[model samples]
Target chain A: MNLTVERVSAGYGHVRVLDELSWRIPPGVTGLLGPNGAGKTTLLHLLAGITRPWQGAITARDGSASVLSTGKEYSRRVGFLPQHFTFAEEMRVLDTATYAAWVNGVPKRDCPAAAWAALEQVDLHSKSRDRVKSLSGGQRQRLGLATALAHEPDLLILDEPTVGLDPAQRLRLREAITSIGARRTVVISTHLIEDVTYMCDRVGVLAAGKMAFDDTIDELAKLVDEDAGHGFGSAFEQAYAGIVARLGREA
Target chain B: MTDTAREGHSVEQVLPRAPKSTAPRTGFFWPLGVWYFLAAFVVIAGVTLVRTSLELSFAYEEWAHTNGLFQRSALDITGPLAAAFGAYLSGRLTPPSRPYALPRFARSKAEFLAHHLLPAATVVTAGYVLGLVPIVVKTYSTATTGSLAPLGFVIGIVILNTLLVLGWLFGVVAQSAFAAPIAFAAGFAATLCGYGIGAWNSVTPVVGDVSTAGRVETLAFALFRGAFFAIVLVAALATAAGVLRTRGFQRRLPPVRVFAWWILPAVLLAVGMVRPPSPAVREVNPPKICKEAVGMSFCVHQAHERDLDDLVAEVEPIVVLVGQENLPFTRVEDTALHDGANPHLDPTVYYADVSPRYGATGDRDIIANLIAGSETCFVRPGWEQSAPGYNAFMLTLRLSGDRESGADKRFGKLSDKQVHQWLNSHRNQIRGCAITDDLLP
Candidate 1:
């Protein structure tokens, strides 16, 4: 299912994070790029149903239900991997996945198979019997992804899922996300522009809690001046810098 | 290189998929901490049993009833230890971000709380229940009258669960590095306070001296106390849920539903405080177990039937001596069968205050105390120096087989026949506490 954020405002205590932020996410890999303290995680939290919007609403594109009104139903269809997460270390990998599926409303009888499918998709099925504590950092990230995927949710929201991974682990994770994006909507919030260029079909740059740039990768590249640089990295960097600079000017 | 090999095989050529097992895949994996708690419970329970056994060795009367053993084993020390472990487990399980994490899941608030809290609660509760096993076995071996006191055990369990719930709430609220220690202290204090209250006997698993005849614990009073603790358990859970729901959010009073949960407990508490139940022990007239020996009949409470043989062996010789001497009393009875409100002053029957702590020698002391006459009389300050009732004292020492190193030398020695003759003449006066220096030989 696609999601639409309409004129939403949210924050922690006295600090306003998102201000009248509006964005549409279609069913494909959509990358959210933002600088530090730019409200990327807060926006993801709102989408994941972990936090409530102070004003406006988040709803399915067909207007069937709003996240605020249909919380359990919405949560059942959406899986969220927080930026920082921990698991019960003593639990087996498959058991952790199965528990996640059961918690997301999967039938108890189907949980094991669903967990296996999710594990196979992430290429972590070989390590399913190992204790969670025995996993390395990248394997744990994949296990988190497997937990999110075990319930076969329609929308998977991952916040900085590849933040601390090595380049090889990042590429493997990006490949997994690319294959999973074929059949589901995946929203990835990250600081890496390469993640968007390599895997995302569409990208949104969040600046000062507002969507400063939202378009296809080609369009974003076009916004970069030809005199600036050569490769995709330079062009994307130039484009992101331009958006932040423009947001600064507006502020 | 063949033509069929060059093309892909048909879809039906693959092996058939295995049938899905359909069995529930959620294998419960208890955290290492739960195992640790279980081990700790075993060690603590063993230590408690050994300590209690040693204490009871000197006071066998205390171990003669199942209810007493249940109280000493289940609540006296294990209850507080269970609460502390419960708090530590909950604190370790729930981090500060749990409240933020739980709301994102599809489970209801109650389901989530149960999933998080039940494991720790179960381990603690199961530990409490298992701790009662050795005590029950020990009591079963010797106790003769009262069976297990169900009402008292139920009250103990309710009180224990209430402590656990309170500890769980403390851990949930104080999700910090020091939460475990603070929760442990708070849990221990809470259970101790429950024990400290005046209604402790009502809540405790002690059915006071059910082995004694004419005594029983009132079920209604015990039920009321159990109900109070059950209400506290519910209220604590509701409070914990409320705290979890509002944590990390803007601070405000709990929602109406949370307050609604407390209404019943509050009403019950007020009613209970206003007019509480009466004393738990009540009077009952159970049939006495009797045995005849040496021409004198001996009777005791049914709970003391196991002690009758030993009692008879120790007192039969004394009874034969008294019979030979033609003493006024012809029968010995257990004091437990006596009605304290209305004294039965039959001169033919002597009442003996017996306990399981009394061995053969201790039983002999009972007869000596009776023959020595009443010591509560208002006598002169120098009565002992004057050797008042010296004949009676010598007769008692002879009956009890006690050494006479401190006997008065001023009074002349008397044989058993002379003492018996003096006792026959002054039996009524001795019973009435009328002994004087003039009564001595």
Candidate 2:
């Protein structure tokens, strides 16, 4: 799966958040790193196809087939887990997953099974009958994952998916992402450098509503040398800090 | 290095049932309790007013009477209340969290609209239905007597829905929760202005005249008014949907096209205003359905065809009393003498005011009073000269054998026959506008 965004400009009312932003994401787990208002979520929203860009276009292709050309079909191939995944508090985990499947055009008769399978993939099948409000923070985050993955979309976009998770849950999410990324594209937006080092093969850094870097971990690490005495952190973290600092200086 | 990353490969391989991709469903919560509360308030208020007022019997007379009650309740209370509250609620319908944003994988806008409006309309309708219970009770209550007209109730529901949709559309257009008070004010002001223009008056669901067989005409008018409301409702819904799609879903606001949809309703409204039906259309008598009793013809409006026999029965004894007086003529008409335009009215005709404040078609006391020359109009509003009028009126009662009061004792020892003779001699004055006993010599 390949997703392309070109000169995309989107905003809320008069405040423009994503201005002439452009980037290309290929089939793999790509960690989207940015500061708070860096438009990472906006870009993800654009990719999810829920919100439209004021200017420019986004096109997605699965091999030779145009996924973005037909909306419902494209929607079937793109999964989006929003920054704050909101569902009815009283809804059962299974029902929430089923609803996600149904909205994505899973046939009514097949929704239950599809939801079950998606929950099982997220290790949430055991708690499928629990109300969303009753679930722990980590459990809810997993449920969010299950909801997004229920329809088995080809391009999964998760916005700060593990924001409130404990270390164990974060590890669990990293594993889930890696497993899903093997056969499809996964874009995880976050501020955590560890996520990218642990789960992603490639990293895309966004700064000031624009993409500053899009390259493999090895290529990014090449930006900083070990003898430079940059930091005591890992090589990937040193390189990431260097790239972001360089981008800040340039801006 | 991470244990989770190593488990990822296995988690994926073990559970291949997961979809490669999926989007979130629209999880917006419908405000059911608010609607229920609104409905309850309207119903309670309507019931209280009707119960406290003494005008219940007239509502049972026919569709017109019931319509009169609905018109009063809706215009005086429910319409403005519903519009204001509905506007406030709709203004808060969309927030950043629940954008009311169009779903990525929905079948069509119709389906989307259904998902949005079905629950909303249901809640609103439920509230409206709750408000109508008092009306139903009034229709069947002792003071009122009639079978509830489903068509009348349906029209009431449509009117309410139109008001609610208009308020909601206003809120959606405003696009801010803070605009709720403004929306409420605007809705109230707009409807009030519409009322002032008199263009909206005919849209009131009052059945003005039901004595005639004008059901076809009333129904036709009802349908016309309904169509007018339907057009407005559809226009508002389309406009809101257009906004939601362009701004939230499509992210490209098509201002011109979205606004253009309103022209349909505007044109229809203009047509309605320009060619609105007259109040006379509702007030016009139905075809005459007459019955004879006590050697006199008792004719009523055609809508009262079903009640002619009962009316005749009520008037029979009165007619007999009037006959015994040997008056020149003895015809009693069922007309209410509204603005004095009854075609059947003549010098000999005795007009019964069967309005809510006065007579009822089936009330024996009122029918007897009408027959015994009940004097409803007096020159002044005081009890000072009330005795003379009461004495004059009591003479008729004595002659008719309906009742004998103290004033009858003041007849100066005259028998019922003599009192009848005296009233017969002064029949012209008695039937005249200023009813008096000046010719008592």
lDDT of 1 by residue, B206-243 (tens): 32223334455566766777787788788888887776
Model 1, C-alpha of B30: deviation from truth (Å): 7.1
Error of 1 at B34 (Å): 10
Give lDDT tens digits, candidate 2, residues B280-300: 343444345567667778775
lDDT of each: 0.66, 0.61
* C-alpha-based local distance difference test score of model 1: 0.66
Best prediction by DockQ: 1
The residue-level lDDT of candidate 1 at B220 comes to 71
Error in Å for residue B328 of model 1: 11
Error of 1 at B376 (Å): 5.0
State the DockQ, from 0 to 1, for candidate 1: 0.24
Residues A51-150 of candidate 1 have per-residue lDDT tens digits of 7789988875424634442355677777888777777676678777776766666655556766777787888887877888999999999998988887
